[model samples]
Target: MNNEKVTVTLELNKDEARALAQFVKRTSHSDCEDKATSQNEAYLMMDGVNAVMKSLAEEGISPR
Candidate 1:
């Protein structure tokens, strides 16, 4: 068995990026039946989004 990781490149326009960010932000703030689990997942998702956006910004590929 092998465990490995791969990198993916996503090409999104400014509007699409903005929309995705907004969606992630909203998800991070939303509630559900499984509050703890759902919120954890949302926060993790938000963190991933932030990390990617930060990396892109560092590379001068920001939406703004």
Candidate 2:
């Protein structure tokens, strides 16, 4: 795998962000992992997703 990293910017409304967080939370690791990527990369991606969820909660945009 390439070690290069890229930045991604999204423009999601509060509800959309909340829904995305919930969806990521419900997704299984095996279901989300790609056949070409390493396990560590998948875990790191999950960690980044978790960070976004936490940030959304901090902004008071959590799911009911």
Each prediction's number of clashing residue pairs = 0, 0
Q: Model 2, 1-64: lDDT tens per residue?
A: 5657666667788778878878867756665476328788777777666767777777777666
lDDT of 1 by residue, 1-64 (tens): 2335557788888777676655544444343323546766666556566766675665555553
Report the error of model 2 at residue 6, Å: 10
Task: Give the top-scoring candidate (TM-score).
Answer: 2
Residue 1's lDDT in candidate 2: 53
lDDT of each candidate versus the true structure: 0.58, 0.71
What are the models' TM-scores? 0.45, 0.61
Consecutive 10-residue window with the lowest summed lDDT within model 1: 25-34
How does candidate 1 fare on TM-score? 0.45
